[model samples]
Target chain A: MIRPLAGMARVGLRFQLAYRSDVIMSVVALVAQVFLLRMIWTALYGGREHDPQGLTLEALLAYLSLANLQAFATTPIIPRIAHFRIRTGMVFFDLSRPTGYLPQMAAFQAGHTAGGLLMLAPAVPVVLLVGTITPTEHPIGYAATLALGYVISVMMSLLICVIGFWTLETAAISMLYRLVSHFFAGTMVPLSFFPGALGVLADALPFKYMGYVPAAVYVGHLSGGQIGQAVAVEVGWIAALAALLWAMWRRAHRRVVIQGG
Target chain B: MAEVVRTLRLYWRLQRAAMRGALQYRLNLVIGVATGVAYQGSGFAFVWVVMHTFPAIGGWSLREIAFLYGLRLTAHALYVLPFSSLIGLDWLVREGELDRVLLRPLNPLVQIMAKRLGVGQLGDLLAGLVLLVVALPPLGPASALFCLAAVVGGALVETAVSLALASLSLRTWNTIAVRVFADDLFSKFGSYPMSVFGGAAQWALTFVLPVAFVAYVPASVLLDRTGELNVPAPVAYASPLLGVALFALAYRIWSRQLRHYQSTGT
Candidate 1:
C-alpha cells in the first residue's frame, strides 16, 4: 500500500515537472498578486491605525503573500478527475482495480499536493526577502497550523469536487465556490474587517480555514484558546467531509450508467 | 462611416438572436442572473466588513466607498454586457474560425465580434445599476452630471481595454494566456479605489492599463478628490479618451490580422 502511494507520488512529481510552462504562469500570477496586494494593503493602513483586530499592515501583507502562495495548493483534483472519469467511464473501471477507492483518491491527491508544495520552493526565499512580513513569533507553530490547514482545505475542496459527480450542472456551484474562496479566504479583504452580521457568519464557515485562519494564526490573531477552537473545528469538518465523500462515491459508482459512443 | 453603421447593424441583429436564445431558458437565465448577483453581492458585504474594521480607506469613508463600489460595479456590468462577446474572439482566431467570418460580405473582425453574444452578462449590467442606485449618495447637480459621465466613460474604457487585450491574441500565439491576464487585470484593479494603489501602480492604471477609467477617476471627480492623481484636473475629466483610442485601435489591429489569416481549412 505504501509502495503504490509512493509510486503515485512519483508520478505526480514527474507530471508537474513536465508542466514547466504552466508552472511559470502560476508563479508569475503569484508574484503579481502578492506585489499588487501589498500595494493595496499599504494604502489601506498607511499612516492610519491598522490595528483593527490587532492587524498590523505589515503582518496583513505577509498573511496575504502566504495566502496567494497557498491558494492553489488546496484544490481537490477530484473535479478534474471527475470530469475525466465521467467522460471516459473510468469511475466503474476504477472499481475493478485492486485498491480502496477512497484511499486511491487520497493517495493521488497527496501526490499532486506534494508536487505543488515542491514547486513552492521558489516562494520561500521570496517571502524571506521581498515579501512583506510580520516578525515571526511562533514560526514552527505557524508552520504546523499551515500544514494542517492545507490538509483540511484539500479534504473539503475534494468533497466539493465530488459533488460534481452528483450535480451535472456545476457552473453555479463552481461560481459560488470561486466567489466564496475569493472573499472568505481573506483573498479580497481580511475577515477581521468584515461588517456586523456577515463578519460573524464568515467566522463560522470553513471558508476561513482555507486562508484566513492560517494567516491569522501566523500573524497572531488567534490566541491559544481561539487557535485550539479553530483547529478543532477544522479537524472536525475535515473528518465529516471525508466521510461524506466516501459514501457519495460508493453511491455514485452503483448508479453509473454509460452511454453509447 | 458606412462601415461602422453596417458593423453596428449586424452586431445588433446578432445580439437580438442571442438574447432570444438565452431567453429560451428563462428559468436558467433567472438563476444565472441570481447567481451573478450573489457572486458580486458578497463583495459589498466584505467591503462593509472592512469599513467596520477601519472606518475608511485612503480617506474615503464607508458610504463614499460604497458609492465607488456602485460606479465600479456598473462599469463592470457595461464591460460584460456589450463587449463580453469580445472575450471569445481570441478563441475564434486561434481556431481559424475567422476564415468563415472573413468569407461573408461583412468584415470578419466585425462578424467575429458580432458572433457569440453572451446575454448572461446583462445580469451583471442590471446588478451594477442596482448597486449604483443603492450606493450613490445624495449629490448636487454638478456631481450628478459628473457621475453620469463617469459611468459612460467607465463603460467605454472597460470595453476598449477588454477588446484591445482580446486583439493581442491575434498576433500572439498564447490566446488563453492573454485572455486570462486581461480578465484578471481589469477585474482585480477595477474593484478597488485608485488611491489604494501606490504612485507608480496608479500611473500604470491611469496611463498604461487605464482600468481606473472603469470607475475611479470620474467618480473621484464627483467625490471632489482630484488630489489623488498628480495629473491636472482635465486628465481625470477626460477619462473617456483612453477607451475611445483603445477600442478603435483594437478593431484596427484585428483588421490587420485578416490580411494574414490562414483559415483552418488549409
Candidate 2:
C-alpha cells in the first residue's frame, strides 16, 4: 500500500516540477508579498519598536514572513485538481482505481506539497533579507503544532474539493475560499490585530488553526500552556472535519456524474 | 471611418452572444460576482483595520486612502469587464484555438476579447463605485469631468499592461504567472499612497510599472494633495493621455507579435 502511494506521490511531484515557470513565478510572488508586507508593517509601526498589543515590529515581520511562506507552500492544489478532473470526466479513472480514491488523492497532494517545499529553497534567502525570525524556545512544540495545522489545512482543502462532486464549476467557490481563508487564516493579518467582534469571529473559525496557531507558536506569541490548548483545539477540528468529509464523500460517491465522458 | 463602425458593431454582437452563453450557468455566475465583491471587500476591510490601529499612512487619511483604492478598483473593473477573455490566450494558443481565431473575418483582437464578458467584474464595478461616491469630496464640474477621465485612463493603462503581457502568449509561452503577478502588483501597490513606499520603490512603481498613473497621481489631483507628488503637476495631469499612448503602443506590440504566431501541431 505504501509503495503504490509512494509512486502516486512521485508522479504528483514530477507533475509539479514540470511546471518550471509556475515554480519560479510562485517564488517571485512570495518574495513580493513578503517584501510588501514588511514595508506595510514597518510603515504602520512608524519607527516605534512595538505596538500597544505588545507585538514588536520585528515579531510582526517574522510572523508575516512565516505566514506568507506557509500560505505559498500549502496553496490548495487538490481542490483545483478535483475540479478539473470532474469537469473533464477524468475523475472516473480515480473512482475505478483499486486504491481508495481519497488516499490516492491525499498521496498526490502530499507529493505536490513536497514540491512546494522544494521551491521554498529559493524563497528562504529573500525572507531572511526582509526580516529575522524570533528564535523560539519550544521548537518541538512549534513543529508538532505545525504538523497538526498541516493536517487541518489538508482536510479543509479536501472538503472544498468534495464540493466538486456537486458542481463541476468550482472555480468561483475555490477563489472565494482562498480570499476568505487568506484573511481569516491569519496569512494577511495576525488574529491579534483583529479587533472586538471580528477577533471573536476569527477565533471561532477553523481557519485560524491552519495559519495563525502554528505561526503564533513559532513566534512565541502563544505561551507554553496556550500551545497545549491550541494543539488540543487543532486535533478536535481535524477529527470533526475528517468525519464531515467522509460523510460528504460517501454521498457524492453514490450519485457521481461524469460531465464530458 | 465606415469600416471602423462596422467592426465595432460586429464586436458588440459577438460580445453579447458570449455573455448569453456565459449566462447559461446562473449559479456559477451569481457565486462569481459574490466572490468578486467579497474579494475586494475583504481587501478594504484589511485597510480599515490597519487604519484603525494606526492613525494615518504617509499623511493620507483613511478617507483619502479609500478614494485611492476606489479609483484603482473602478479602473480594474473597467479593464477586466471587456478584456478578461485575453487571460485565456496562453491556453488558446497552446491548444491551437488561435488558428480558428485567425481564420475569422473580423479582427483577431476583437474576436479574442469577444470570447467572454467578465461578468464578475460587475461586482468590482459596484464596490468601486460605492467607494468612489462615498469617499469623493465636493468638486466643480471640470474637476468631476477630470475624475471621470482619470477612471477611464486608469482602465486604459491597466489594459495596456495586460495586453502587452498577453501578447507574449503569441510566442507560445505560458504567460499566466507573469500576468497574475502584474495584476497583484497593481492591486497591492496601487491601493496605498505612494509616499508610504519612499523614493526608490515609488519611482519603480511609477516609471517602471506605471502603477502610479493608475490611481495615485490622479487621486492626488482630485484630493488636492498634488504638492507631495514625485513628478511635476503637468505629468500627473497628463496621465489620461499617457494611458492612451501606452495602449496604442501595446496594440502595436500585439500586432507585431501576432505576425510571429505559429500554431502547435496537433
Q: Estimate the TM-score of every prediction.
A: 0.88, 0.95
Candidate 2 to truth, TM: 0.95
Candidate number with greatest DockQ:
2
Clashing pairs in 2: none
CAPRI band for model 1:
medium
Candidate 2 off by > 4 Å = A47-50, B260-266
Please provide, for model 2 over A1-261, each residue's C-alpha lDDT reduced to its tens digit, 9 standing for 90 to 100.
898889889987887899868788878877888878777777778845447577777877888888888877877688889989988999998888888778888888899889878867877877866768757778988888888888888888888778888876688888988888889888878998899999999999988876788888888788789999988988899889889999998998887888775
Candidate with best lDDT: 2
Candidate 2 CAPRI-style tier: medium
True contacts kept of each: 0.60, 0.54
Model 1, position A82: C-alpha lDDT score:
50
